[model samples]
Target: MNTVSQTLGQAPSAHVYKNDVRRKLLLIVVFFILTVLAVITDLLCGSGTLPWHVALNGVFHPDQASPMVHVVMWDLRMPVTITAVLSGIGLAIAGSLMQTVLDNPLAEPFTLGISSAAGFGAALVIVFQTSLVSFLPVDYLLTANAFIFSLVTVLFIGIFAARKGLSVEMIVMLGIAVHFIFSALLGLAQYVANVDQLQSLVFWMMGSLQKSTWTQVGINAVIIVLVVPILLLLSWQISALRGFGEQAQVLGISVARLRMLLLTFSALLASAITATIGVVGFIGLVAPHVARMLVGEDQRFAQLMTMIVGALIMTLSSIVSKMLIPGVILPIGMVTSLLGVPFFVWLVFGRSMGRR
Candidate 1:
């Protein structure tokens, strides 16, 4: 077995255990430090600023707090921070699972057209100016709508990809084709949208937490809580499935059954965020790689570390983004893409350097 597998397989290979543990420990430490910095930076910046002491006092004791600070910190920044963190965690987990399942280093939420389909769904709602979703509570409706559309898109891709049983290459290609068709539809929707609708559509495309509320955070939290445990539980079996597709068939792993279940789960996870938050890329692609680099290739270790680092990166981005414009909020997708793109580019290029 490779060193990474050895570490994950047996309980007591000291070299494997110690190395894995140490790396995870370091990532946790880094994540904690980064999250704290992001929170502090977010609290300290904005169009209107708060004194550090006043903000600190507000956290521990609500009284004797500056009203402006209270509004900005408790109302504005707090929810934004939470949304960014949770969204980051959700996307990161999705990316890692996809790569493992497809056995492709480049398999990612966006690359496979999942995010594109999601963006198209959200665009249809905003561009059409439809109140179809008005029956739902306003705070959560958009996200719910986005999730529904995303699942629909996923279903289309899933059905197409399920020929002769499920194959990773087929699904990936199906996703790519679906993405192209949806991209054109989204453009058409944008073209017909009025100014207000256009603006809404544009912002959703950019992916920002400026409009986020704690209510949305609560909804996202519930979905993540529901979905993640199931994925983590399947980690060992998933690892075995890699490069052993036929072996999986022989061992009674219902290839089609597993694909359907996983696709539904991934659709829920991805669609929930897409409907609510628009399309935030990179976390789903970048976080998993960061996890693997830190803790080797074990999914159990990888998933945990990815969640931690994804939260950290998003929190940091939101926090730092606040400082960039003082009072104005930058769309978060811009920040993540900026940071995540270069790293991913390097990963694509750096593969030649990887030992086979």
Candidate 2:
């Protein structure tokens, strides 16, 4: 009788698990379709709006299209659209990894000073015309500097956290200190800058896609593509860590080593995007929360959904940035900040109330 009862109980749980997997998969498909639509909409709604048919024709047959249409479609709109998608994917995944590794709901690249560090690096180049790498072209000085600074900052924090076995609170505090330091440095750079340099610094910090090139897009694409699959390969372990916390060590997982590895990859993703596009904020913080709400904490599903949600949010933000001003395209970072600030407030209050 006991055996029969156990079988009955197991049967229902197995059925429920299958159903849950189906629902999560369905949500992923729906969100992916929505993301594709958002991308298409972004491609269509620039300063000189191209009709869908014309845009499609230009995309499919650039040689047959008019010279102006080809230039606008390929040279102008395509790079920005592709870069926005890549940046969103990179930032969102980085944020998800940070939150999981640190076990902190509020942790993300922007919140933890990585983005600020990148901005400061770019400011350094803009103010001094200096390049960390002598072989890099003058145009790439800002990008190389931003990448190196951001990487160094993250590695410093990661090393400290690993060696000291610091708690999540300490990690967060360290990140805050780094953020302030970089902000002060950035302000000092701005103070010393001439009018043209100040203008360039301010614009870069605001995060526009106006300067995105095919090269930048290709570099971001390769990094994201490589990093995401490695992350997914470790997804089961990540999910175990999230579910079990410190007890995950009982299952033969080296919590310290895993944390360090995840942090390094997260830094790589965040820094690369920041180097390419300046300091776009909050997509990292927001997208993972939205993904968890949709698909619980299984990193396998949550990570994929986070990327889709991030891409959708960014592409939508791009559309708004263009449409908000009649002739002027507002900075992409400003649009995301406008959307993210209210959501951030709600999250803080919601969590506090939940604790109560």
Candidate 3:
């Protein structure tokens, strides 16, 4: 007993804390470096006729660069990459929030019904686009309408769950129901769409930044800046509330309020991304988990790492997507899903073994 007591007393408390701090700092640095690399790669690598040298110069000295380089780097590439990075950040944050609130490792923006709801809304606009132009600008009409309808899905879940003090099962089921209904509506709308509308909707559904514009980017940036800070403020509450529902309540946190606020921000974030770039799958599900595993689940580390990891993935995937076909451009969602699915399989089956 004397020997055991002495050995336990020498367990190295200060050393452990110092090592943890060092590891966290190292992870933070790595995330930043990767994010920078992803952005630079996005700028330098594309299918455009001009080389990397001209594209780099074009960022600051557009006059000296070739017209194609200017258009590709600034007009096209910049907006798309920016949108992708922001969307990734938004989705990753949403995923982290859902996982915490739902108390499920698999909860994500799409799983919670935001994507399906937004998809339905976009499909409705696409089906009736020709008829709605007089009421609103063709582009603006579709984006706004989609956003509003997606909010309805989130509201439905929030309201239902909140009424009974916001059961995790209830919210999850509500989201599932919303997904089914919206999916049905989307299919029906697709059935009635004209050729041009169908093509546009299909492409949008597949997801791409091929159509990025300064106006869309501006609107998204405004919404992101407004919404993300709100999310950031809740970071501490989220970390503390990671406990199961009853424990969370006992801890003096309002579960319903937290869920509502987080859900609203998540809905807006997903809507903005869907409106601009369509649905980039698995980002929400995949990114937060990666962050959590890398740096632990403390919300500060989780959120920061989530954003950095997400942005890097999006930017890199986008570059790969464009380069895959040389001259042809594939949808961003396609690339994400292609990469995300394999990663997810590994996360589910393989990662557990490594942890053990």
| Backbone N/Cα/C clashes per model | 7, 0, 1
Candidate 1 collision pairs: 46-326, 47-326, 47-327, 143-275, 143-276, 146-275, 147-271
Best-performing candidate as measured by lDDT: 2
TM-scores across all candidates? 0.87, 0.96, 0.91
lDDT agreement with native, every candidate: 0.74, 0.89, 0.80
lDDT of 2: 0.89
lDDT (10s digit) by residue, model 2, range 33-149: 999999988888789867889998888899999999999999999999999999999989988888987788888876568878998899888998776775888888899999999
Best by TM-score: 2
Native-vs-model 1 lDDT? 0.74
> Which regions of candidate 3 are displaced past 4 Å?
1-15, 63-68, 130-135, 350-356
True-vs-predicted CA distance for residue 69, candidate 1, Å = 3.1
**Cα lDDT tens digits for candidate 3, 173-243:** 87888889888888888898889988988888888887888888898889878977766777778887774
Return the lDDT, model 2, position 20: 99
Off by over 4 Å in 1: 1-19, 22-26, 29-33, 63-67, 131-134, 137-141, 163-166, 243-246, 249-255
